[model samples]
Target: MNASAAARHPYLSPDAPRVLAHRGLVTPDAAALGVAENSFAAVAEAHAAGVAYVESDCHLTADGAVVLFHDDDLRRVADDPRAIADVRVHELEEIMSERGGLITLAQALDAFPDVRFNLDVKAAAAAESVGRLVAPHAERVLVTSFSDARRREALAAARSAGAVRRPATSPGIDTAKRLVAARALRRTTRVRALLADLDALQLPERRGPIRVVTRGLVRDAHAAGVEVHVWTVNAEDDMERLLDLGVDGLVTDRADVALAVVNRRGTTAV
Candidate 1:
């Protein structure tokens, strides 16, 4: 079990390098495939393919229900310009019925009893609700966001909801920048401090043209007992390269391909 780095956060699979189905497998031909991102059908498809970890985002609806959705509004999926926060949960369901059935946070949790979810709290209003909803299943859920304040707010809410073990988390955008600086300066103390409570560094392989994941950063994170995971990595060659480079997880839109790559790669030396 390569679980030492994430020992505190057991949601990460130890048997193999992790593969997180980013928004649940909306492939390159998503419209043709009829796979809607963050929809129940997508998640079901992921599980059916034997993928264990699913990464999704959360937003609150007008009716106060927390949903597994990605966008601020229904523009892309439903072709409606109305904001998701302006629509009720049932209304959102109806909007998504044909593309892919929408699932509430509670329903997702209840239904996928064995799956580990990496949930991004996309909306500020949904932060507290997300934390509370996942409190009981803290061990099986990872909570994160781009905003540090929003991310911490959700974690704090989870703690207030009586979560004993902290939910696994990644640093937000601001915190990530701080980490990058600390790494570049080789400030071991600052890097350790920045990574104190984090389980993984979930990042894009690059931010614009600046390469975000590097050997130095990965080494530093590992020395601090944290794992590095790259997001939305899609291509087969890219998957093999990143895994070979020692990323602990891959958050990908092509989980089927990722899984096959991981299997063929077959636990290479870390």
Candidate 2:
């Protein structure tokens, strides 16, 4: 793909470098702030802090409602032994009521109408339902999963649910590995082939010290009109370094600090 064809999907913000709240900004010391990961309060906090994209994961409840949560069970917030899929949405909501309010997929979209969401389908069973829910709101969502099959299934479900425009998507683990191999071989054609319907390459800066987000990877991904977003980046220094390295976005638990780092230089580009 040529440079012009490498233009990103319109679904992504035009802002040169994006900052995304990973699981809605629940810090390691969240107890002090009384917010929990994937909680309504956490998302609200990110929104109040002026983050444009909030990254979250989805799982199914016993009643089959799709919810914005990261873990498979209630141990983190409620300390309950029940799995998320084993309990109904309302029950989980009640369990988390005092810690950080819980909200359904529909409720999250409705509550934060102005925000763009980067959703990860964490469960295979929730894939289709998640797709259907995000279909009408396709323009503002980017759906993904570590499981590539689940990722594609979710996208297909969204398309089947009357979405004229498919939601933006990031390549899952296997697809990303292919891109890595192509990058290693300096094969732009192969890289382009992998980005067919994808909008971005969202990845970690390093996978167990293997160092995934090299300058070449960023350049190649961008060359194919796909953006590169590094994940779970925290600390002001790392944020600045990744931005300096030309990553198109940062998925962080500290959007507050990341935003300040980017805007400090007044229109820093990645």
Candidate 3:
């Protein structure tokens, strides 16, 4: 574990380099045992592996239940041809029962009371409900979406629901793009302005050939009181390299492996 940085927010407290289980953990062994991503089992396994953070996407069912799921349609995780918005909560639960178990936003929060969640509001329709569900638990939840408008909508709803503390947030695609431009131009004031309301800069390491999480980018993000977290990194070498680059977090499918790497580095994250 790296030395703890100054706490930026409650969600980011004890600010050491950390690992966020991407969609929870579905290791090769777990997958072989019929586990599925974003299932309750996946998150349980990550928790069992001692990971403190989990990243997942949220969608709303037809009956207005917020579920931890990725795609709009069921074609990928479930072989069903229907859209999630067309299915009732119980029906979706039935489908997920065999594949590890359905994990609603509520259930995940309740079950993993000690873990922090980084939830992506995947659908515009699910945004408000996701916010409402996460409201009371706002201190441990981070609401985000690719659409800046959608992300803000959820945050607004959380406030409406009387969140005790504002949830942590990351920039959407547009804001991230603008931030990158500001960074490239060395506009110090503009960079801070762009990050004024954000807690983390969660991003891909690169966009095609354009590297997004460069040394300077990491430095600037840290200077602005935001932590930089790279997404979808699974390989051990990549994990090691990114940690060396001074990233604050790694969003990976292999939290188990990440923990091992972190341990090997002699920096166990609290």
Higher-lDDT candidate of 2 and 3 = 3
Candidate 1, 144: how far from true, in Å? Answer: 0.4
lDDT of each: 0.86, 0.85, 0.90
Pairs with steric clashes in candidate 1 = none
Clashing pairs in 2: 6-225
> Tens digit of lDDT per residue, candidate 2, span 67-96?
999999888677788899999977887887
For residues 100-135, could you state the per-residue lDDT of candidate 3 as single tens digits? 899999999999999999999998999999989899
* 156-221: candidate 1 lDDT, tens digit per residue: 999999998778899899999999887778788999899988988999999898899987788878
Top-down lDDT ranking: 3, 1, 2
Clash-forming residue pairs, model 3: 1-267, 1-268
Q: For all candidates, what are the clash counts?
A: 0, 1, 2
Task: State the lDDT at 8 in candidate 1.
Answer: 47
lDDT of 1 at 15: 41
Which window of ten consecutive residues has the lowest lDDT sum in model 1? Answer: 1-10
The candidate scoring highest on lDDT is 3
